[model samples]
Target: MRRGGDWKRGTVERPVGAPVFDPTDERGEETERATSASPRLSSTLLQRGKSDAADAEAICEAASRPKLRKNFVPIKSPEQQGAQMLARVRNQFIGRRTQLANSIRGYAAEFSFTAPRGLSRLQQLLIDIRDDTTVPNLAKELVEALAIELARVHDQIAKLDKKLMQLHRSNEMSRRLAAIPGVGPIGATLLSIKVVDARGFKSARNFAAWLGLTPKNHSTAGKNRLGVITRAGDGMLRTVLVAGATAVIADMRRRGSRPWSWLKDMIARKPPKLVAIALANKLARIAWKLMVSGERYRPASAVPMPTPT
Candidate 1:
């Protein structure tokens, strides 16, 4: 016998002509029919089986998730770290040395013992004050302590400088950057480390932006406005660039060359500070291009001129 157009079960199956009960028949009957007819519903059973298999597979995969591997870049070696640490310590010492000298000078000024304003004059001033009978014993003691601290600071800086020079000799990248004018040992070392991948930037403009040398923008509606530099990148690098630019500017002036006519024009028109910052921005861009291209810096005249119209 057959039921719902198929044969099933050991008991006599209901005939196809037998009264077909609606699924929405009395609650108990519907439930009984649904339970009894479940196995006969081959399509639904297969679908449910497939769903269970899929869920089990998903759970197993989740439970056995692959271990994640760390991909951290290699850290600096112990020697490099040591060198950097020494350099930092030396910088701090130099700062302390300056502070000590300044404090002594201030103290001397209070006693009408004015010393010339410069580090070179510091030792002489200290000596003069120490030898003077007019200075109180307490003041002399303070001066002596400051002098000792200054000497210690100088010693530390000197030691660090020697270590830095050794490192610079071993570092080819540092040496290459150092070849650039106005970039000394400190500048070269810092630039090499700070700019790990010069090619990370696509263009010189992008490099300049990375160094926060790009002009800031403010726009509303269809109008656009440009202002000072964004100052959004490595502050230390930016500072070094400014110092380098200032040195370059001074050197150009001494040589009777208008190296950065744009800066000179800006200085004539705008504030000195603005002109300085602009020059720094130009310097940073120039440095970026030089590093990325592995090219030597050439003055404007040395650079090939475009074909004239």
Candidate 2:
């Protein structure tokens, strides 16, 4: 309920001689020899409170439950943490790059020197502004400064992308995930970085749900009502999956290639955005199975994909 164990990430070590089932941390660990851990929820129905003492009491009660192991936060190695850090920084740079590009475009539009969309077009727009004599030199100077910053951000992103590519090449799981139809290098690398242990997920659907690819349930009176995707889990990972799915659909349409029957049917009935989300969900499930079972991907989806392990 507290939205994953992100609040407790980093610097916590699985002590050299600690039990795998019982991990010790600075604050607490659920072991007979030390303090028991209770992953705090957004709100404990058993006891709603606003003070530290009340929170501790609630945590103690929650830890008394019989099945608390599933809620334990997965500990990360230094390498895994570094990988996540790299991916996050790259993602941030990408966002900043887009923002800077848009700002430059908006400012350049004032001078009636608008360029087409796409990052490549941004550089050309800057060139046009540099050459245009009618545009005020002052405005040009400001835009030029933005362009410089944008270039710096772009260089940083490219460097990080190269590092991720190298990691993907060396990581077997990432390579296997990239084999999935809708998952490219970036999406595959994200899955590998985020999913430390595939076995921890009971099934493919659970993995998909964890990635926030599944629909939300709003059922009542024994009537099943499904809403839009919950959009939980890692926002960046989900976004990459959906973007990759959208690209896959576009390629399929442009080349007039045969898509999986279900995908084709969905495309026919659903709006393009909805179809992309569905395809992304399928990709997430497929990725989960590959990670768990170490199976090769089958492009032909007519043969059903493996159920989540």
By TM-score, the best candidate is: 2
Which regions of candidate 2 fall more than 4 Å away from where they truly are? Answer: 1-52, 64-71, 300-309
Task: Write out the backbone clash pairs for model 2.
Answer: 204-308
What TM-score number comes out for model 2?
0.82
> Per-candidate TM vs. native?
0.64, 0.82
Put down candidate 1 lDDT per residue, 1-309, tens digits, no spaces. 335543332221123333323233233332222111211222222433556465444333333333211111222434554555565566677778889888888898888887777888887888789889998999999888888888877887888778778778888777776765567777777676666567656776776777787789997898998888888766777777778767866786789654445565666698656666677666666667767777766755422333433
| lDDT (CA) per prediction | 0.63, 0.78
Spell out the clash pairs found in candidate 1. Answer: none
Error of 2 at 215 (Å): 1.6
lDDT by residue (200-241, candidate 2, tens digit) is: 888888888888888999999999999999998889999999
Question: Given candidate 2, what's the lDDT at residue 135?
Answer: 91
Off by over 4 Å in 1: 1-87, 221-228, 300-309
